[model samples]
Target: MSEPKRKNRENRQHGDRAAALNLFPLPPETEARLVIYADLLHKWQKTINLVAASTLPQLWTRHFADSLQVQAAMPAARIWADLGAGAGFPGLVTAIRLADVPGVEVHLIESDQRKCAFLREVSRETLAPAIVHQGRIEDILPELAAPIEAVSARALAPVPILLGYAENLLDKGAVGLFLKGEHLADELTDSAALGTFARYEFSSIPSVTSVSARLLVVKARAG
Candidate 1:
């Protein structure tokens, strides 16, 4: 890394730590695991296109914090499935956070073999209970043995198509929590018009990164 870029990463890390302490504090062990995961991600990014190059400087805040924030939405969830888990955003982060909890399992579904290899290495290194499923999201969902408590995707697809991929899981009693960018309103509007998720109540948590970003939480509607 260049001097300027290294300095920027350091500054961002410092800021993200401060913000995390105030808003998203983790247990000591969990914090340590995240440090390990971040280091591995940085090392991997040198050759592979894991995350976007532009966001590398703000990896802590933009990716880690953004991914970690979802824990608050489903505090008691034990089983999670992350669709299109490229580079293992929320999936790996969640697994690291819940590493100490018994029966906790995170399934990271990614189509790319290279990304799956990275996910497997991270899981092994961190000792996080993550199951890497190397296949299409559609193909993997049906093969899961049991219903997941939560399903998530980050920067994967539009709301409508995401819902389509997640429909089976949702019907099996899994709640959907997706990380969406600035155009959430437009996406939600477009999805609603498609008449999908009619029996669902959708809510959102504003991302810590910026006001334009949000974490959309979906659950079945009550009778």
Candidate 2:
């Protein structure tokens, strides 16, 4: 590679490292799998538009790290359902991390057929053990047979609406781990008015970009 290109790659790698500084170190095998996942994402991006065009340069920190942090928060959760799992942020990332673990499964629920096709291909190529559920979250949650230990969604919807979509799973004892932005306070206020059956614990995301973002862990119960 030319000097300028090499320097740019090095800078990108450094940025990825800096953004992931707060996450627990992954085992070598898991790290290798994530590398494969990232490469596949880039290759598919040319045709599918898996993520926002602007975020492509910071794929590792912005997308991968943002997703991996959720697994760090809920380490004990083995079975997860990722709603609106577009491009498979936390869901596919979680599956890649837990690929070798016994009984680990991540169900990726995406409504868009094209996105679902991309997700399925990625899962198969990476051997990530993710089951792609191609349908609306409202239609699929009730039909899930496995007992979901935790649920996750990123950049999906407001807390109240997300809770409503995950209501069935939440009522069945699945905890929600959602990624939200600066509007958390407003979301909480709106969710209160909606009489949601879930409670949330908010914490700052260990990210280099957008300090306003947070990790919302929702504990839900039957009302």
Give TM per candidate.
0.92, 0.88
Q: What are the lDDT scores of the predictions, listed in order?
A: 0.87, 0.82
Q: Write the per-residue lDDT of candidate 1 for residues 1-223, one digit (tens) a residue.
A: 9999989868877776667656678888888887888788889999899998888767777787888887678889999999999998988988988899999999999999999999999999999999999999889989999669999999999888888988878777889999999988888889455578586789998887778899999886666
List runs of model 2 lying over 4 Å from the truth.
Answer: 1-3, 14-22, 197-209, 221-223
Model 2 residue pairs with clashes: none
Q: Could you tell me the TM-score of candidate 1?
A: 0.92
